[model samples]
Target: MSVRTLPLVFINLGGEMLYILDQRLRAFNTSEDNSEKGVWSENDRKRVMNDIVGTLFSKSFMDELLKPQQLYSHRTMKTVLTRLAHTSIMRLNPASMDRLYELMIMAFKHQVFLCPRPKDLLLISYNHIDTIKEFVKDTPVVVNQVNETHRKIIEVYSSLSEGEFQLLRQTLLIFCQDMNIRVSLFLKIKIQNPNGRFAMTTAGPVPHGIDVPGLIRTFDSKGREVRRREFPNGGSYTSPIREGSFELHGDRVIRLGVNMYTADHPEETHTTKTPSVKPNDTPNLLAKEELNLLARLMGSVKAVNMPGAEPGFRINLFNTDQEEDEAGASAGAGESLFGVINIQAMQDEQVATELALIAGQFAEKEEESENQSANKGDELLAMMDDL
Candidate 1:
């Protein structure tokens, strides 16, 4: 279990969430039929994007997240993401949230399984970060935050050895193990089989820095190549492409973490749940100290509602209320059991004390920042008057 696994998991899943939300929001705001047009506006969509991205890359939260730590359990991660999603005004009901989570996990699981080499995981994460930067491109503050975090990611993970990357990939595979929900888009593209597993293609360019299969070379005792032989390897392959850029800016050279949802393929968002897709009912025995740390990290997320904010509206993942109801009805027992935590129920005195301290500090920081922004605005207005 690599300590580096949590950042990748959070980032990829967050990227997936942004993709789904962007599609759903676009559908509502720009549908040709006009029936869904009034529900979401361009401003509303921007606000949701800004709020979620800001909170996700918040200095406090990212500072905590980038530290060395064990990967969180699936349930704990789900709960954290649920909170992250609601950091904006957009709301997801229990059923819609469940479906959204299913789509996110399955999509990322496919990406992970199809990754050519373990070290390429960094490329995949770069793909996600690139797209995320695009999402908040208009917001310079958030873009700067993302850029800073990008540098941090490169600084931390770039120095890791290949074996460490391999371990990280294995840890991610374990995290995604047994998630087999069938997605319509993958099935439509023939990339996923009927039973939900992604079909691995044996015919393609091999990973960067790897030679194509079917060649064997014999070396003499003096380390000179004595003979070369070729064998039928059952698969056709080609030379690998140039390695992807690992810097803050360049092509990631892979599409695994890129947004797949588009207006042209709204039907692709549909997911077919199977009986084997049962939720993990076993309780996560996460340590109390870790839970406290998570609570503090998440406590820094800004409140969704503002004093002069517009009225909030819900964003449903399904096309209609009926589908949402059916999904809710079909959800397995114990699926919702661990979706949230009751902080009040924690009996640990230390946890409560730490949470209170974090809350107070966050409140004070927010207030001071608001004051600084207000003063800056006043100064800008005065400068314009002088002009």
Candidate 2:
């Protein structure tokens, strides 16, 4: 496996997470019932964005992450992201968090699979960084943190050989192998087949630095071109447009990692539990030593909790709390293959005990609204059923 693949995976997945959160936060802010709960104001949105982005691109964390190392196991990575998402006052219950992570993995997997060239992975990462910068434009410190990491990305990846890039891409593909969870957005756009694999189009422009198919050239013994011929190719193709800028600031040309969520085209975060095929039964278990190392790297950043007077609310990825509960129940029974990895009990007791402790750091806050009044809960349930 390529040592360089981990950064791309983390950055792209983090970007997708931000996109989903931003959309959901906006929806909450505009809801008519927002006033009943604490209103999700513009200031609240900015605080959440600033806190999460700052933690994600913090200098200490990024420094450790940039070092060459093996890719993290799925559980370890999920644990790390769980910590990151809870850095702000926002919270996710077990079920909502599982759905949120599934959406993130599948979204990034789609982008990597459709990338035109292995080298274009850098462009995709840059697109994410650029959009992240936009999210925290008002905070100079957070913007600088993002900028510093962007420069580090360029310094490390810009000079890599083509073969190295190919290896990096292959490593990513292996990580996402068999992760065919169905996403509603992808299905609506017709880019994903009913069975969960993405559909590739043959009519787009060829990858940069590549010649369109249908030309044949014959060379002589003296190493000179002797004959040239053209044949009818079945598909239409065109020359690639200009290469995207690899610098810290510019258009990224390709749109793979850019934020697809917007006010005009809103998207809900829903995913099916069943995959197209049964995933591998064997688990990719994490060793105790590796878990300790990851804990050390992540231990420095603590998730902030709201004061007693300030209220924290949960963000549900499903349409309603009842839907989230049902999904969580199925997953608890090991019936759902989240991100193609079965959430089985770890064989190593030490590792399992340690991960539980780490997870407790971001445990969901109590839903005060639910406990406040039974009549309110009934009214909400009645409203949802009516809808």
| TM-score of every model versus the real structure | 0.75, 0.76
Residue 290 C-alpha lDDT in model 2: 41
Q: Candidate 2: how large is its RMSD?
A: 13.0
- RMSD per candidate (Å) reads 11.7, 13.0
Q: Write out the backbone clash pairs for model 1.
A: none
lDDT of 2 by residue, 1-387 (tens): 898877788888888899888888777675444465744656777888898888878876676678776676565567667767877778888788877888898888877866778998887899999999999999999999999999999999998999999999999998887778788777776777887787766676778888999999999999999999999878887787766421111222226788877644445476775545444444423234444544554443223342554556567777777887887787677644445746775489888889888776534222232222222222222322222
What's the lDDT of the predicted structure labeled candidate 2?
0.72
How many backbone collisions does model 2 have? 0
lDDT of each: 0.74, 0.72
Model 1 per-residue lDDT tens digits across residues 1-387: 898888888888988999899888887785334245348877788889988888777766676678776676665677678778877878788798878888999988877876778987877778888999998999999999888888988999989999999999999998888787889887876777888877776677778889999999999999999999999978878777677421111222227677878866678788886556444644333333344544554453334355776545788888898988877875654456447655645478998889899999987885565444333323322222222
Q: Could you tell me the lDDT of residue 357 within candidate 2?
A: 83
Model 1 weakest 10-residue run by lDDT? 245-254
